[model samples]
Each structure stands twice: as C-alpha cells, then as structure tokens.
Target: MPRTGDEFITVLKKAHIEWGNHRHTSTRGVVYGEGYLQIPRSEARTIGIFNSNSSNTHIFNCNSTDGFLVNASIKASGSSTANDVFAKQFQGNGNLRLIGDWFRHVNAQVGDQVKISWTSPTDIEITKL
Candidate 1:
C-alpha cells in the first residue's frame, strides 16, 4: 500500500535526510548516490528538499514539517543501479507539498552537502480524455 505524506517524512527523518537550515534548492547537474542525497547550497528554499531516488532514477521529495510528499519526479541516469527495495518504511508528518514513491535508501548524514529545489504544488483540473 502507498504511504501517506506524514508517514513518509517520518521514514526520511529516521533514514536521515540531510538536515539543513535553509529550505529547498535545485539539482545543478550533480548525481547523488546511496546514503543521503546531497543538497547544494545554490538551491536552498524555505520549505523543501530535492533528492534523487536510485531505484527508478527519479527525483523524490522530503519535507521538514510534513513528512514525505506523494507524487513528485526527479531526473536520474539510466546507467545507475536499481534501488534496493525492503530498506525501511516512512512515516508522515502532514505537510507534504508534492508526492512520490517512498523508500529506505535515503540517509542524509551530518554535514552532507545537498542541492535543494523549491517546487510549489500546482492545482491541476483533471478531465476525462
């Protein structure tokens, strides 16, 4: 079953998403590997963190107050290794702005430089095609 936003964040925190004083930032063409995605200093935001998921080569979301966003995407290289499943479970904190797949590979350690990006949630009006 898919996890909620709050549940997701809890998992991230436990896994250790790089704790930064500033908010979000963008990926400046740097590739992040397993064990804590790096947030660059140039892309800091007021309330967001950008990360690359190693599994499907996608960018995922992790927030401070709100746990994990649900369905967001990131660009990754096709040559990267597949992310290992069955790592850990995420718990939400209820402040997710985006959404995506949650995993246990994130482990932002102390003093890890990360490139953050600010992505506001867009309200889209869906219609049957």
Candidate 2:
C-alpha cells in the first residue's frame, strides 16, 4: 500500500534524508558553523530554499543588489526567534548561501547535523539533530 505523507516524512526524518515540497534527498555536506550555511544548489532548489525564480548567479557583496532576504523563524534547542537570513547564490559554484547570525544563536558548529524543512510554504524550521 502507498504510504501517507506524514509516514513518509517520518521515514525520511529517521534516515536523515532531506524532504520538503514533495521532494527528498539524502545528500550530505560539511557544515561551516561560522554564522552561515551553504546548501547544495540542487537540494536547495528542490526544497524551495528561496524563490526558485531568484537568480542563481547573484553574488553577495558590498553594493549588492542580486540576493534576496528571507524572514524566517529559526528554532533550535536553545532559541526561537524571527531572523533575517540572506539568501544568495554563489556566482562561481552556484551553491545556495544562507547568511545570518542564526547559526551563532543556535550554537552550530562543525560536524553538527541539522534538519531543514518548511513548516509552511512561507516558513522554514532548522533543527539541530
């Protein structure tokens, strides 16, 4: 029999597979833990990390006008607050960049595991697992 959505999510969660927007991936990468997170472009696009239509070649720098701002409430074991996560696409590697102090607030570090998913269409929740 076919499994329900919640059941599928449960399975994904157990396996540490990334899932959202009817998409899932098992790709894993190293965490910087330096107040920023870089997500694989393909996975980020699949999970709707930012508006898909947003330019993926935009670089973030002084006098920047290429990236977009995401207002999200990041919830970790230690904190829960609305924060601004600047979303940008690396011009060279095309990775998805989420820059903010949220990582510091959550006390993320190298080798830490995190699960990012959409709590709603407009909300993303990141949990350190």
Tell me, by TM-score, which candidate is best.
2
Candidate RMSDs in order = 15.1, 14.8
lDDT of each: 0.26, 0.30
Write model 2 residue lDDT over 1-129, tens digit each, in one string. 111111101111211221111223355543332133344444443443332234332222211112132443222111112331223221112322232234344444556665544434433444555
Tell me how far the alpha carbon of residue 73 in candidate 1 is from the true structure, in angstroms, after superposition: 14
Residue pairs whose backbone atoms clash in candidate 2: none
Best by lDDT: 2
Question: After best superposition, candidate 2 residue 20: deviation in angstroms?
Answer: 29
Error of 1 at 117 (Å): 1.0
